[model samples]
Each structure stands twice: as C-alpha cells, then as structure tokens.
Target: MEDRLVMDGLPAFGLEVGAFSSVDLVTAYFGRIADVSNLNAVTDPLHGIPILIKNNIASIENNNTAGSLALLGARTPRDAFVASRLRAAGAVILGKTGLSQWANFRSSNSSNGWSAHGGQVFGAYVQNQDPSGSSSGSGVSAALGLAAACLGTETDGSILSPAQRNGVVGIKPSVGLTSRDLVIPISEHQDTIGPMASDVKSAAYVLQAVAGQDPNDNYTSAIPNSIPTLPDYVAACNPDALSGARIGVPSNVLELFLDFDNSRQVEVTSFLSALSTIRRAGAEVVENTNFTELAAWANSSAETIVLRADFVTNLASYLSKLSFNPNNITSLADVSRFTKTVQPGPEEFPSRNTATWDAALDAQSGFGNTDPRFFPFLQENLFLGGEGGLLGALDRHDLDAIILPTSFAPGFAAIVGAPAVTVPLGFYPAGTPTVMNRRGNLVDTAEGVPYGISFLGRRFEEAKLIGFAFAFEQLTKVRGTVKPFVVPKTEIRRGV
Candidate 1:
C-alpha cells in the first residue's frame, strides 16, 4: 500500500525516508495483531497500524529536518516521545512527511507545502489547489490513504488547516495531552503533535496510542492521572453523542471572514447546513454569541509578541540539545545566516527571508521570560484566551462546544492551548474560488475544494470533542467520498 501510493505521485516524505519492508510489517502484524497473538501481554491497541510522522518530530531512523536546509542532515539520537509511544503501542513507523519550511515560520509570505528540502506537496482532491500546511504531507498522505494515519504538529493551524484543506480528520489535542519532547519547537505554549486520519475513529485511535504524560516535558505534569483513557476515547464515538448538547455559534467569529463580497458564500452555506444537522442530531444551537473581546485579541499584537518571543527562546533551546550539530547552527540567528547563503533569493522564495527571524532575535535580546513586554503578552493571551476569554464564553453560555467555521477557529484554539477536532462538512463546486479578500490567494479554485467544520472544546476535553465530531461525521457521511488524485502517466514520465 505504501509503495503503490508513492508510485502514484504522493510527495509525502523527507530525506532518508522509507516505509517498513513487507517482511517487517508482516512480522509486526503476526507479533501484535490480536487475532494472531493471544498473549495477554500483547495488548497494544494500535497493533499493526502504519503511521507516518511529521518530519519535524524526531525519529531515530529518519533524519528530522523540520523542512529546512539548515538542518539538512540532522538526525535525533532517539525517537520523539510520541513516536516512542506509537511504537510501544505496536504501530509501524512508516516515514517522515514533508512540511512547510521551518513549519511555516520561516517567512510571512511562504506558501503552504513549499519546503526547501522536500519541495511542494499537492492536495489529493485538487492537483493544483493549495494544500495548507505546515502539516502538508501528513494531511495529504492521510487523505490519499498513503498510510493508515499520520502525525502532525501544530503551533497554530499547522495541523487543522492542512487537515481541513485535504479533507481529513485532524485533532489538535490540548498542549500537554501529547508530549513535545524531541519535536521541533514553534511555541511551547501552542506546539503539540496530533493525528490526522481519514476518519475521526482512526484519529482517535492514534491519539489514544500517543497521549500520555512524559516526565521530560514539564507541561505534561498538568495532565491529571485520571484523564480520559483510550477506552473512553473509543467509546465516545457514539453516533448519538450530540443529543442534548448545547453548541454555540459565535457570529463575531464567523462574520469576521464571511463578508458578502467574499466568495465564501458556499462555505457559509455549508456551515449553516452543518448547524442544521447538529440541531437535527438533538444538539441545541446557540446563535450569535458575542465574542468581540476574544475576536479583537485574535487580531491584536499580543499573539505576535508572544509567538515571536517563544519561538526564539524555544528553538534555541531545542537546537542546543542536539547530540550533533555539524554546522554549529545553534540559534535562529545562525539559521537565518545559513539560509541566505544557499537558498534562492527573495525574488523566488519570498517567504525564506530573514526578517521574521531577525525580529524574533531582536525581541529576545538579553531578555528571557523575565522581560516585562513578554509577560504582558502571555498575561493578555491567558486573559483573552483563558478564563476571561473562550472559557468564559463557554461557561457563560453553558455550551458543550463552540461550532465555528473551520477557517478561523483553529487560531483561537492555538492561542489558548485548547483542543479542537475538524471533520469534513462538504465540498464546493469546481470554479468556485475562495474568498478573495483574505490573507492568502486561493489556488486552482476551478477545481472543486473541500471545507471542514471544527468543534472546539475546553482544554483536555478531547473525549467530548471526538465524540461530537464522530456523531457529526456519522450523521453527515461527508468524508471518504472525495476521490484521490492519480497522476497522469505522461506527467509522471516527464517528472512533472
């Protein structure tokens, strides 16, 4: 299955990457499959499943490039905590998938899926449309069934956006639910590894295998010992889970992007239909909740200040732990200098410039977490995104989860370290361009594109989110219908 998909033109892997040989896969199945092995000790729930991990997450056998030329040959001495857990649970480590260069933090104008090391990753549904990233390859591989499931890390929309664009199920667990040890850092506050799969159940299965506390990561200490376990996650897939649930629709959030002049009417219509479906499934729909304060913060300088500061400090710390740094690339400043000497100039790779990195380095000048400016950013984020923000809105409204258009809701979750599950809603017709009055341009809108809706819930409430997503998925049956792309023989021959 893996080789066949690669042959069919799926550019989902990074350097020195290869799938497990057939013999090894068969052996793993025989040793761990419940039907093949009856040993009481062999109780791995993910037995025989093949998982493709994102390149940024360290794997002992694969080079962890984090989609940058600066770390071209860097390999970790051990697997990331999540990767080790997956292996312990009997999952086959397939390979590392491509991602945006530096996980989309390299430049302000960097195109999604365009990595200096792995090139551009295309979407399975539309060959020429944007395959949102920096989880580009993971999402595409899952959507195309290249592997049973894939792992993706999110600082913000890295996991959710790509999953939505590729029409797959993506769950961004609460920050500490999955350990971040050995994974490349964007922001400790927001960076988390999650699963992207063809369905919510598969995603939940992967999540169960990976979610746990790791002593190496202090954040995981916050995860309660009695947190939802694997069985709870599986059981939550009940189709009737939405009954009597109250879902809030923040008009302030939706209207931020659903302007009439934009070409997102199709998306708006699909969202309304989804709301109707949720209501039909016995979930009460709360309309037009005012989240003006939270929405304002979403566009404020707080996010930029916090993320930039965190990126510099966290990335330097991560680099300092490397067992081998052949190039001595120890800081963001070094990375910035290295890229300029080798990569294409701004004329071509507009997003690979050093401006962002420079700014981050400047922000961290002799200032650690003690910087007064830094604390305000974190304090404001906690207030607007925490108890006084998203949590406040939910508590005040007495809602189960907030249902927002998939497009912008992920950002809110990232800021607050909340968990969110996105599932397919529907697709727009061919030639239907996305909203033109937006941050990025829509590519190949002439080809039909898929849109998904997200269910955002309180921190560590993944079971509820997964259950709600599963119910909606079962009711809608919106996934699995989109056909995978098969490259033309002529194009393959020409290496196009």
Candidate 2:
C-alpha cells in the first residue's frame, strides 16, 4: 500500500472485482501492521480493509498493555467486543498503535502521546507535534494513512483532540453506543470507543461494524430498543443532509475557549467563514445560543469528583476481569506501586509522579459509583451538561444539533455521554508562530497545524452527526488544503 493513501473502503478497492485478493491487501499492508486475522466470507463495507486499534483495547494476539509497562504480557481471555466486531466485519487487524499511558489518565504532567512502552508518538504534520492524547497514535496514523483508519477510545478528548490535531475525522459516540467490555477503562461512566479516519464516510463504516448493544457492557443496554436493528450509518452520508437542518453555534462555548491552548485567530477566522459555508449548505444557523450556566458548570467540581471516583472503581473492575495478569496488578493502588518501584526506569516516577492516581486514591472511599456522593455529583453533571448545558441549548434554540470549534466541545458532551463528531475545520497559517508544549519537547501549535469543528448531539444520535459532518467535510474539504511537513514516500507497497 502507498503512504498517505486515504480510503474508507472506497468503491473499486479491487476486491469485489477480483482485481486482488484479501491476502494481497494484507501483504501490501504488512509493514504497516500485522496480526492473526482470517479472511471472512461476507462483504461488509469494512471487509478486506486494514485497520489499526489503539493499544488500550484488548486483543488475544497481542499484549493488552494500555501503553503501560506494568501490564506487560497480560492476556485477555477474548478480543474486546469492538475488536471481534471489526474482525467479523472483515477488517484485518493491522496492529495496535501506541497511546498515552493509561489513556492519559496516569499523570497530570505527562505529554499527550508519550507512553512508557512505546516512548512517544509524534505527528507527521510537523517535527515533534504533540499528537494529542490517549488516542494520539490512532489519530496521527490515520491522517498519514498508516492503516485504512484506526480505532480510539475517548474518556473526554482522547479521540477528538488527536483527530483534530492530525487533520482526520473522529466520531466520539455516546457512552453506550459501543461496548467497553475488555477495553481498559478510565471512567466507565465516560469512556467510549470510536473511530478516527481520513474521512467521515470511512469512520461511519468502522462505526457501523462495532456499534450495537453488548450484554457484557450494561451501559450499551441504554441503546434504544425501539430500533431492533443497527442503523446503516453509511447510508446516512447524504451530501444534502445539512439542507434545512437546524444547527446552533453556542457563542458561550466558543467564548470559553477563545484563549485556550494559544492556537487561535485562524480558528476563530475559519469558524466565522465556516458559518457561511454551513448557511450556504442550507443549514439554518442559530447563533449566540448560550449555555445558561456554562461558567458555573465549568467551574464546578462535579465532573472531577465523578471521574476520579469512577476511575478508582472502574480500573479495579477491569483488572479483576483480566484472565492473566503478569504483575498481579489488581487495583489502581497496586499499579501505582509498580510504576514507582520499577527500576532502570522509563516511567520517570520521581519526576512525573502518580499525581492523578494519587488524587483518585485519595478520593477512594472504599466504594464506587454506588457511594452516596456519586449520585449527587452525577445529578449535577446532568444538570450542567443536560438541562443547563448542551441539551438545554438544543431544546431552547429548537435545534437539531449544536456546533462548536472542536476544542470547545468535548467536555460538555462528555458529562452527559452525548455523541459528537469532529471534522477538519481549518489549519494555522504559514506564518503562524510556534507554541511549544509544557514539557517543551513537542510543538503544541505552529504553521500548518490543523484544527477541527465538532457537531455535538443528544445521546445515540451519531448518524445525524455523521451526516452533518459529512456535509461540512464535503463543503470545506479542509484536510486536503493543509500539507504536512513530511508526506509518506509510498502510497502503497504493492504485493504480487
């Protein structure tokens, strides 16, 4: 396969016409990824496609380490539900991409894409770009077309942020849309698995393969029973889907992020220009729709209180279910000890420290979500993200979906487990000044760095978001406008 060859199993992959065999595609993608995969008989949209999964998601063929050395060699009894679904849908498991250690929940001081086992993953957009968290590897690899696309999990910004930085399309489904069983957890309440792909349609195909209710993950039970069969997400990619659709731009959300991350001006200008695109595309734009208590909501401790408590409980549950544990790491505390004690060390325990885990453990009250404090915090979260936040904004503005620059969107939706999709919006100008990451090793912002626009909606509404994203994606086609510092040499390594 060639380098940077963007595909979402586009028509004429040569498989259906017998131009090449599934084995041929596999061998072509060999250097890009590898693993145990059987050619399936069915012809799903994802069939015969090569896809990479983030390291945190468990699989039988490789060590499911979540980018941490502590769980090295640990084995999962079976593939994570998403992995099995991908295989069943005929996607070849190319290989696992590296991720932020413990999905970027381990250390507050850590770099976005750094991992103990994989070192650090740098984006191809520029030298040492911050590759944005948790799903960092998946996002960058997708943009460079390392595989057909890559899978990622989001507790909050894991998938979206990385996708935006890498100039790829990412869909962060509602909490229960995809199963979490066997995928490592940060907070069961917030964690979700979704795809980061070169385009929205490809993402839809990847999502179509894995989405549906799973008995193992109770959260999936929340998916509406009225719809007996999974919706055909690919069919939802209507170019005219945005025509007559009511889309709102929450000015307050944009206000909150105006000075965030120091990469502005272009985004603000691009966003203003994109609103005209949205209007010209026939979507009714509702501007200045404010989140009634956004400031109060953002200032509250409810989200943090809920996440830390859930993490303590969720991590223990995931470890307990692991079939084989080399380190006997049964709880968050046990894992913490291993990180600090492991010597000749890449963990950099003394300097980095387990501050995030320390805080989680400190909040650990010998109970999980069932604790008395949990429900109240959840209630506050729902009020903020639900009634007074995005939900209220949608209902009050009588909108189909709310749009914001991707940077401003994730947190609000995360609280309510609402679905969101981030599509390429714009890139920084050529003369833009560079901004270095906190650790000062990676570039946080600079000329040619890409950003995105997100469409956030009510729970289980991904199909709608996909349609709007596809429409916006088609309108701007921004990904192609920005060129990376380095483009891959080959689009494909053809196999005979």
Please name the candidate that would achieve the greatest TM-score relative to the true structure.
Answer: 2
**Candidate 2 ranges with C-alpha deviation above 4 Å:** 1-12, 32-49, 225-228, 259-262, 363-367, 493-496
lDDT of 2 at 33: 34
Task: List candidate 1 stretches off by more than 4 Å.
Answer: 1-49, 226-231, 343-351, 363-370, 434-444, 487-496
Please report, as a residue range, the 10-residue window in candidate 1 with the lowest summed lDDT: 487-496
**lDDT, candidates in the order shown:** 0.74, 0.81
Per-residue alpha-carbon lDDT of candidate 1 for residues 1-496, written as tens digits (9 for 90 to 100): 1232232212223211434344444333233222212111111133234577888888777778777777877766788999999889776686777787788887776667766666766666665567788898888777755556889999889989889888889999999989999999988888999999888888888888899888878898777653443336767888999999999988876676765335666777889878889999999999876564755675677777787788878888889878877778998888877777764552234444656676777743434344676888788887777665667678889989988767767777888899999998878776564432123543634345778899998988999999999999999988756664542221111111
TM-scores of the models, in the given order? 0.85, 0.93
Q: How does candidate 2 score on lDDT?
A: 0.81
> Model 2 over residues 105-170: C-alpha lDDT tens digits?
878788888877777888758777888888988887787666777899998889999999989999
Candidate 2 lDDT score at position 209:
88
